[model samples]
Target chain A: MLQKKVLPRLDESLLTHLPPFSRLERRQIRTILDQATSRRYDQGVAIFDEGAQADRFYMLLDGYVRVVRITPTGEQVTSLHIPAGQLLGIAKAIGRDSYPATALTATESIVLSWPTRLWETFVREYDGFATETYKTLGHRVGEMNTRIVELATQQVEQRVANALLRLINQTGRKVEGGIEIDFPITRQDLSELTATTLHTVSRLLSGWEKRGLVESKRKRIKVTNPHALVVLSQG
Target chain B: MLQKKVLPRLDESLLTHLPPFSRLERRQIRTILDQATSRRYDQGVAIFDEGAQADRFYMLLDGYVRVVRITPTGEQVTSLHIPAGQLLGIAKAIGRDSYPATALTATESIVLSWPTRLWETFVREYDGFATETYKTLGHRVGEMNTRIVELATQQVEQRVANALLRLINQTGRKVEGGIEIDFPITRQDLSELTATTLHTVSRLLSGWEKRGLVESKRKRIKVTNPHALVVLSQG
Candidate 1:
């Protein structure tokens, strides 16, 4: 969970952490960051909602954020979780003047909000801004490509397995026995994320529990044999 | 289809064709274009392959390109067609270091290629470079989002109708009888694009042809009732 004071310091260090920004470019980044505002959110608080106009693009100094799409039944399909040092908003930052997805604080989060116009200005004046943004763009497109393949090619079981593996790889917190998903995600959330029925997930988890592959509590699961789990995922 | 000479003078003017590029930004873009090398691809040439390492990025000066992926059974899925004025080799330009999809020229095409490192430099040094790249990134991500929604929410009939709409909207070439898809495409290609089977596509086309909604020959299909098709798509 992200809860820290990170937005107050308008420094080149944060700017250089992303691609293509050198120390000199960091000075210009400082100029831009100085103009930014700081914001914090408690766990489960929404940073922004779907369709919000792109006013500010936030850089996470500390904490994690979740991007989700709310279904008709009020179910949230967790599309992705953004940890520290990654960008928080881009759809609105680049186009359509809108936030395409909803953002919620997964932990205590500290964020720096720059006037969306500042991003535009920096993009105009700084080469680092544009290239870094492009790199970010490549990543977003790659992700969507993977998701399309998942939806079109993989079945429910495979999708769930891959999703869990992805979570473990990207945002898992190591424990004594195994790795726990850093976010406090529920089975229902997992079901929506995989586009499968909750009943199916419940059954699958029960089976995995008995097989000593995973341990599930009310809203958490600890992966045991990650490699074997991946082999099962191959099925 | 795009067929134009890659003249450096066109860089400033190309900005006029797209929105959001200020006059000064146009000049900045020209610098990036100045580094580009002109290349040509004959019809049926493979510009890049799916899963291949992406090393360079291309901008179409002239000709049509088909972006495709191959399945395990050797079936090909037509992902998208690139027209003139659009950038190609997106995965490389965006820094994936690999081609996400293959680019196959439908006709002889003129493309401008930049050294992968130079492109990275431009992304880092040129202001317009990063913003333009981010915009391109936004465009691809938005396109993929539409595909995800279509795959999840739309029925097969509606999907076909929407695909026709998309084809017409992107690259429809009007002929004597009606609107023909700009490239040489088959029912099988259409099936792959819409994620349905060829037999189902054949049956659907037959039904539409009977209703005068669309007409098909050996490999071409022309839309007759564009509005009616829209209604069908909405259904």
Candidate 2:
């Protein structure tokens, strides 16, 4: 069973800066918050699983979530890494009755969720809700299209480089040596992200480490030379 | 030049059955039709090109369109085949200023288009316009995700089989021998769609032809045994 902790009441100010709530008045934001329930999840917790009935939608308030898809052969593919202040498990927005992918917390995170039944009311009554939600969905579609093209045209090495670059762009933090991915991501995760085998990922990372292009140790990856990776990805 | 020929005023009946217009009342539909311009595109005509200013969005009223993307190395990839009664060039909805891909007519087609400036008005005013439009975008995203998984996990032959199956399901018509793709699709197009070389596609199709799986001649392909292809795709 998944572990969760119900949080205290949410404040409207907590949501005022979020894209989905940014356009609403304070009263409207309060109304939205009144309908939401906040909870905290421990690291590595699966918030929802693919093919499970989607009864609620969430907005991450604190940490990162990995959107995962399991193939027919039981191979796990890490499709996306979602950050704080964004919505997740928006099955209703997509007109799906069940979650399309599993959401797993990469760090201890806090999220606010609303029952799926209120999705239509929120879309119709809340100003800018539907527009912002659709915008987010459109952005996701664009990213998926780009990944499809990359898989269809680019070489494996290029794809791996692009995947790292994308990760750093989304969740990078400046460290002493270089920019480090802010979460504990394994080589196996990299392989899953790039659609390659762990052996290939290990080999490539070892080579990159020797060349000083990146540094990897203990489930952590830091890009020492992002420009080099960018150039490699372009090819 | 795009060979422009502006036709007479559009009748509201032309849009009643389309998803974007289905929930709209007759007068509201009339208002929408008043703002749209209908034009006929010849086969192979480019409706929009990638990176061009997205001044307008279109609804395909008749025939089919091929969504194309050219990689950095200038290799053209056919990402999708869009059939009639669907919206295209929806850059505004995606928060984009330019078209992401080129839309090319696969057959002589008719399209109704409106200025991009009116997108926000339509979304906010129409009862179900945003809901339906986003639903379509969500469906496309789902399709893109499926293609991504197929590219990442499936073998070359399986990918080819799945692509053929998708096309047949979308635009196939019953013929004496089997079900034929409703458009003239060349081997080159199949190669691009499946992310393989044309020679490989030719060899595979030839092998399948010998196995009584499919028939290909003069840029037309018919599935003689979809069940066999389905089984191959599963593996």
Candidate 3:
């Protein structure tokens, strides 16, 4: 049987700076720390499965977690990547009994988790916590709505360009030539993100490389000319 | 100058019955009603334009509003529709200063609006209200995530079928023949919703009609064989 007591202690300051928590008082923050425990996983491990009981939620401490949904035929599509210092497994906050998607480790990862039962307690007790959580939800919704419109209206090239821009914006790291996506994202992941095929993504990347708009090798991508990519995305 | 006092008095029960409000106390409910005002718009009129200051937010009372985003070249794509009893123009809740998308009336509409300045007051004073609002935000994000995955994974026919099923679930009315989408949704609207073209939508609907799976005329669509549609969407 698993035991909370045996878990290694973690710095409480990690929770204090995260949004929803940044709104909580020192005492409330301590209460959350008391209820939380830390865990680490190797890359490619499943943190939780789709349709599993969402009895708990997690906040990342280090590394990446890819959120994915398995199609009826058992094919996995990458939905989004969760980086360190953000929350995942939030299905319970909206009163769902099961997770809508599976969270898989994309890199060696550390996460701090809290039992779902305490979700209501925090919402009831902390205004900043509730407001910030809701704000995060709203922003995500808004981003998806934008994607829906883009999918309906933009061409494949434009969609690919926009998806790349979004990925870079979310997790890009400053580099000499330009910004790198800051994670290992395969071509198939970009295809899934933009609703295109791997072949199309490859062809587009080849064209962009020839034009010096971007540079890619294996799973890494860097925007060599972000302004041009932005222009292309607008079309 | 637009005067809030010139608006017609709305039944406070409209706010009382809505989510977030449904969770608030009677006194709190009265306070919301005091700060609110009713407004009306004719079909095809813009309620709020994209990039406009989001000084207030709205909840529908009657008719429909279509959320849209205009592309760089002036193409308008329908993002989603808001039926009576849901909130719109909620940019401020997420900390944005301007509306992200334009909201236009799909039919003659009545709405109750509250100033954005009071958003914090409500969240701070009423925990249930904040929770419900966040819950709504979370649910919307979840739905959009589902749509993104479907767009990435499903074929056009499957997407169209799923979109119809979703619309029917949201606002269907039982008819003698089948379940009919309640609003006057044009084929163009269906095209936008499903990320297909008008020609493709027309062809699909025509094929469905010949097979008796659905009957669509003008702007109305009735699912004559929901089971078959479901099966088709599963593909």
Among the numbered candidates, top DockQ falls to 2
Candidate 3 lDDT at B150 equals 80
lDDT by residue (A135-212, candidate 1, tens digit) is: 766676666666666766666777788888988887898997899988787777787677677899988889888988
Per-model clash counts, in order, read 15, 0, 0
Pick the lDDT winner: 2
- Determine the TM-score of chain B of model 1: 0.81
DockQ of each: 0.36, 0.62, 0.50
RMSD of every prediction:
4.9, 2.1, 3.1
Instruction: List residue ranges in candidate 3 displaced over 4 A.
Output: A1-8, A23-31, A95-97, A124-127, A175-178, B1-9, B12-19, B23-31, B124-127
lDDT of 2 by residue, B1-235 (tens): 3433365666778999888889889999988888888888899889999989999999999999999899988888888889999999998877787998999999999998889999989988987787788777767767777888888899999999999999999999999988999998888989999999999999999999999999999789999999999999998
Over 4 Å off, model 2: A1-5, B1-9
User: Could you give candidate 1's per-residue lDDT for residues B1-235 as a string of tens digits?
Assistant: 3334445354566544543234346566677556667777888789889888777777787788878776554656666767787777867556578898778897788787766777656655654555665576567666666676666556889888998888877879888767888776688778877888889989999999999999888777788888989999877
- Residue-wise lDDT of candidate 2 within A1-235, one digit each (tens)? 3333354656778999988888889999988888888888899889899989999999999999988888989988777889999999998887687888899999999888888999989888887787788788767777877888889999889999999999999999999989999999888888888999999999999998999999999789999999999998998
- In angstroms, how far off is B171's CA in candidate 2? 0.1
TM-score of each: 0.80, 0.94, 0.88
How is the predicted docking of candidate 3 categorized under the CAPRI scheme? medium
List the lowest-lDDT window of 10 residues for candidate 3 chain A. Answer: A1-10
